[model samples]
Target chain A: MTAGGHTLQLFEQRFGALRRARRTESIMLFVILVLLFAVSAVWTDFSPTQILAGLPRIGEYFEKLFSIQPGRDTPPVAVLSWAHVLGGIKEPQSIAYWFYRLDVYAALLWQTVQMAILATVLGYSTAFALSFSAARTLTANRTVVFLTRRLLEVLRTIPQVVLAFIFVWPFGIGPLAGILAIAIHTTGALGKLFSELNENADLRPVEGIKSAGGSWLAQMRYGVVPQMLPGFLSYGLLRFEINVRSSTIIGFVGAGGVGQELKRVIGFNIYEEVSAICILILLIVIAIDLLSARLRHRLIGAL
Target chain B: MSASVTRHLPKIPLERRTLHWGIGAGAFAYFVYLLWLFDFDRIFTGLPKLWVIVRLMIDWTLFAEWDHAELIHSMAETVAMAFLGTFLATVLALPLGFMGARNIVPSPVFRFMTRRLFDGCRGLDQFIWALVFVRAVGLGPIAGILAIMVAETGILAKLFAEAIENIDTKQVDGIRSTGAGRLAELRFGVVPQILPVMISQALYSIESNSREATILGLVGAGGIGLRLSERIQINAWDQVAYVIVLILITVAAIDSLSKWLRLRLIGGPAARG
Candidate 1:
């Protein structure tokens, strides 16, 4: 009984030492994180005092957004009512009054959707063409893979907004510039995703095609394409959803979309209109998300 | 042998073949219509001006005269904003994550509300948030930080909740067998399992947020984007090129560093190898 107790004591001692070491490590990690946080807060000028001051202003901004402002020859209306929401544009408090330029915004939003679609198509095609070369598992030439990967990296690393900013200089301020910018970024992003998927693809079919004396292109066509098609389509649809968001914001750089209208309303301090446009954008985004999610679910389920 | 092989091949139904052709033709027609609508002719017209900008960027004349210090400072500010924002979001998300997780919350109604709250936060783009916050707080990195914090909180919370939901229930059951209270059970059981995942996700957010924070300055929420937009406005292609290069390097560096840290913390395949 004493011997057994002695061994138990030794085991407890070792376990206790291990626990102490782990505790110290965790404490050290916590200290380091805290230090980093403090430094970052100082560097960014982030303070509780600043936030406290800003909180009221943020609330005020929201209030201004929701409340109706006086239009030319109209009275300011403070409270929101269902009647006001469903009333005509002549009423200052009306949703119709706030979204008076719905036709224009709608056209711009359509253009945004078109830009997203065109960019997605363009990016998807290019990414599909390049992915085979970029994938390490498929491509034999290291140099080709290396160069393609680097190119994709450069394309992906540059933010779509920045790319749109540059394209605006060359392509001029329109949806075309936005399309090119978004397409290029999408190519990079989707190329990486596609190549990764390709790398993970089952390769037995590829070997079988090779044994049949298929050329590299033929092998890829018959062996890999069938397996990767669903994944590509799924990712392409996902990219379309993301591209819609990108196309919306690319307008901020004068690349064409409802974003320019948003920037205009915000710049002019048309608070009600800002909220109106935000509501529209939010609804559209949610709709696209749901639709694409359903489509993706079906695609995966079919697989 | 060739004739016999051809005879053995299964023929596609006529209706299926027609459907395929119709789809192909329809897609082609639609693509053509969109091209015309978008005025594809502009590419040919715009090529000369595009070449001019590209050449000017490549030339990099007066490269030494560029304001390197200001560029570096803005880049640092961007990184700082991302770091601070992500840290704060992670802190705020920990509890929200628990509240949202299905296994933890138990109340489907509460979980649904929490998830919808996350969706609302995430629905608006970070740029939109930055724009609003800029107006609210006045122009600075502070606005950028808040925007990032709000957006990242939603994202990190959702991710953390998913991670928590996927945890091994057996471990939680074991901890419960010790007669520990709810908080104790969570601290010992749930937190330990999901801590690594939470840290990794937060680290990834920090990396992406760094890239995002660069552009928050376009709305006057301070960062390198302000400088970039200023240069673009002034038609300074050479300086723009330099800034783009710097951004690429900084983003890449952050990405690799975050990856390394994640691997070290999480013990991935590389670590195991």
Candidate 2:
């Protein structure tokens, strides 16, 4: 064959091989994924039959949640009406009756919010202090940076609920346990994020401070803290939103919050009360999310 | 000289300084109130108990005596639930994502409703969903998996929809110019562009879901959380410490594995970004 013909043939051969390789690689990945799914499905006992069997029960549970049960004198109701929803607590089908313990729930919800706020503030402060030490660019001592990073990592790696479970023992089953758990977890998470912000901060200011014979603390405060303060606050606000959700549930371990009430109602199978509390939690979470998002937007805008 | 320096200095605003002090004092007051409300005195009283638990955990004398098989199995179950949940959610989210994407659907009302549905699904925490499912499904890894699936479907769908909306329209146009149909255009143009993002997001979810799955068992969803809680209930501090360490290792392992897979599949600094 002519040299030109040979070159063309070789190019085609190489292209075909490349395509074949790509196809095989994708096929291999697909097979591996399928195998993994099969194994996980078996291990988790995820059966379609089970889901199908449970579907009606799930429907019934939800139906029960929407309808109010008959009181000692009231007749059984099949469905809720607008009138019933807006009716007095004496009306068995009324939402007010469904949420008869509103005052208790409200107080617990408030405590949940307070826990979130306190945890956020405490965590933010602690993380802010540790972040400088954790940041390689800010900390001159490598050992300090390494140790601080590891400490933060360990703090965050354990789930907050598990931390709360442990804390319940120490703190005796109250919001204090929950708050401390959330605070420590937040500290770890925020510390890592803050250190990253510190690492990315403008080094010129730090250099200027150092050249002026400033100490490490002075350099960090004058140089890095101001630059990253907005980011820190933004993250802190976001964390508060997350902590609200966490604190709401941290009571599952008896670490004070509305979650404890939720777990109780759930345990006792008080379907209407369960739905009411869930709705309340949802509203609070959404409200906090909106507020925090607005705050963060304004903060970023100002900066 | 002092008078000259004073004259050269800029005048600070009085109200601004007062505002700063006011905010500071108000925050401090709130903090103090919260401290009192949460019963700050408990810390001192709790110190001894905390120390004892801490010491017991660190002792490690009976570490090998603990139930290794059961703990390891529970840990594996947590990982499996996370993987299965994330996998199923990713599968379900793809279609929902297309429906939710503005460019794909072209109907504002439908997209609005879909977005709201996503919001509703996301509004509840995974733990709460786990509790609900535990009640529904009667407590097992299935409950945990379903909970993760429901919660992650919402999150992944939202991310996928955003990814779909952000796709390069020129590619779709190019495919359409080649006499390709709508489905063909999507297959050739859209899917290719968004697959990497979807995979990355799914992998990220898996990492987080593993952490979450560990706790789902607390609500009777089945995982290491059940074991940990059981141990805690029995005051088995040594066993609890073992379970916690195992969880930390498993989570860290999964995190790195997912990171590596993302890097391998995406193939660049873009993966890290």
Candidate 3:
């Protein structure tokens, strides 16, 4: 009975120590909350009543989308004729016809996915080779590292969206422009990530290779590649997910993807078709995410 | 005998696979030749046109008629959309993050489900969601807000959950041994440790989303992007320049503000370092 009581007292003492350490964190959290509230109050015109009032309008829009059809006055689209083959000739005449043209959206989605994959493969492969040279343990050449790192920074600083806009002018309206833009951005990002992974590699094996009088490439191939593959894969997969999403937006500027379809549908106020395309995009993204996470988990465990 | 054998260890030929260098040189020359064939000198001649546009842009920014107060009003609406979207996403991330965290969830099934939910949200771009919501919400700022919220929340939740999972378990274990409830353990033990990193990252996301808000508005979600797009259509290069400048300034301002707030909120080098 006495020993149990002593253990309880010891537990209380440890709890006291934990509480003391946490006090500062709690205070900081409170301050963050207060600042958030203060900023919101000053910057926004957020009235609870306005949010309440807007709810019915939101429901009305959804209802109209679900019940989309041609009325008596509305012209029914008999067929989607193709005089231009390359462009929409008659524009969508009815909401129902727009929904029927899901093929266009699907084709664009495929283009976006293709661009993302091509860019990720190209960018990650290039970065994988260069990262060996950039790693401090692998090479002591400050000049080489500096130039490579600086090059990466400049590349990454220019967002893919901005690059897409620039490419549109020079390359004209096509997926090629989007692919190039995303590839450039991915190269820089993957390079930085790869170098960091290199820096964190188990140096013992690398040192063993060096002591054996191995060439630089020998050390990299035999020692570095094995350690860094998991990290490289994880980063590349993450970039692929990011690229898929960005590819959609790049399409808006005539880069050729589902984004263009989305824009046209919104402009014409084709509500039902808009919902369908959105649902399609969401599903694809969700699938990519689930697949990537599972792959990452398996890789991390193996490592 | 060993010394003599060691001396005979021939030098390994310098692994100079010159083919790679040769290929690189060839590619560079080919690129230059391609550019030359395309009349790359046109870029220099076009500099003046670019300058003219810049000058017109400056004029619009400083001297254009305020008659279109709608433009300014729309700008505010865009900002409001971003703020609301970011706020909603952050709120959603809290529980989603915990559920997705492997350490917190413990059960593989629950973790798997929540993690997939995070990915699904983040996998699609906000612009796609904007198109969808504009249909359902009927072409307004509300649509923009919803799109940004759903997309950003998914991304933020994944990041937050990862951070949570990577945290030291010792602190949590200590709390659990004290007979604390799960919520209490999280409140006192886990939140404190990761809060600073979370805040700093969240601020960066806010900055990024603000820049993105302009593009989201282009899809009729109601923001400065609509004005920018209209100007581009009407050959109003000057106004386009003006709007670009406005966006640049806003993004730059937010960038600095995030840096400052992150420093203060975290209250140490841990904010960045």
Top-TM-score candidate index: 2
Query: Under the 3 Å rule for N, CA and C atoms, how many clashes does model 2 have?
Result: 0
Q: Write the per-residue lDDT of candidate 3 for residues A147-187, one digit (tens) a residue.
A: 88877766664556655654555466667667777888888
Error of 2 at A17 (Å): 2.3
What lDDT would each prediction earn against the true structure?
0.89, 0.91, 0.73
**Can you list each candidate's DockQ?**
0.72, 0.80, 0.18
Runs of candidate 3 exceeding 4 Å displacement: A1-54, A68-70, A73-103, A129-144, A201-223, A293-303, B1-84, B95-120, B132-146, B156-204, B207-214, B220-273
Model 3: lDDT of residue B95: 85
Instruction: List candidate 1 segments past 4 Å from native.
Output: A66-77, A80-91, A94-97, B1-7, B268-273
| Each prediction's RMSD to truth | 2.8, 2.8, 9.3
Quote each prediction's TM-score.
Answer: 0.93, 0.94, 0.63
Q: Write the per-residue lDDT of candidate 2 for residues B1-273, one digit (tens) a residue.
A: 669979999987999989999999998999999999999899999989999998998889876688899999899999999999999999999999999999999999999999977877788899999999988878899889999999999999999999999999999999999999999988898999999899889999999999999999999999899998999999998888888899989999999999999889897643321
Best by DockQ: 2
> Interface RMSD of the predictions, in order shown?
1.1, 0.8, 5.9
User: lDDT: which candidate is best?
Assistant: 2
* lDDT for each residue of candidate 1 in B1-273, tens digit (9 for 90 to 100): 669978999999999999999999999898888889888899998889989998888877798888999999999999999999899899999999999999999999999999988887787789998988988888999999999989889888999999999999998899899998999889988998898888788889999999898889988998899999999889899888899999999999999999988987788542210
The DockQ-derived docking category for candidate 1 is medium
Report model 3's interface C-alpha RMSD after superposition on the true interface residues. 5.9
TM-score for the B chain of model 3: 0.80
